[model samples]
Target: MAEKAESLDLIWEVTEIARLIGRTERQTFHMLQSGQLPAKKVGGRWVAERGTLIRFFMETAA
Candidate 1:
C-alpha cells in the first residue's frame, strides 16, 4: 500500500505546533490564549496558519 502524504496547506493543530516549536501543548495553548501566538478558530478547533507562524518566528528572531 502506498503511504498517504500530508497536505502542506492544512492548518496545524496545537500539538503539531508544540512539536514544531519544541514546547508542550499546554504552553502552545497558553501562548494562543495570551495573544503571543496567532490562531484562528475553525470548526471549534484552534488552528495556526503556517505563514503567520513563520513570520512570527522571523520577527521575533530579529
Candidate 2:
C-alpha cells in the first residue's frame, strides 16, 4: 500500500536515531533538549524528518 511504502522510506523516532548513532534513548533526549538534533514534537512525541536528520548530520560533521 502507499502508506506502507511511505512508512518504509525514511523516518526516525528518538529510539531509531539513538540506535543509528549508537547512543541511549536518554542521550538522544539530551541532544534534543540541547538543540543539537533537528526534531519536531508531534502529538507529544519527538520525530525527525529524514531530510532534516541528514542535514543535521552533514552540518555537524563539518
RMSD of each: 5.7, 3.7
In model 1, residue pairs whose N, Cα or C atoms come closer than 3 Å (at least 3 residues apart or on different chains), thus clashing, are: none
* Model 1 worst lDDT window (10 residues): 1-10
Error of 2 at 55 (Å): 1.9
> Model 2: per-residue lDDT, tens digit, 1-62?
98866774354578987876677999998998798887766777777776667777888789
Clashes of each: 0, 0
Give the lDDT of residue 41 in candidate 1. 62
Query: Candidate 2, TM-score vs. the true structure?
Result: 0.66
lDDT of each: 0.75, 0.76
List ranges where model 2 is wrong by over 4 Å.
1-12
Clashing pairs in 2: none
Can you give the TM-score per candidate against the true fold? 0.71, 0.66
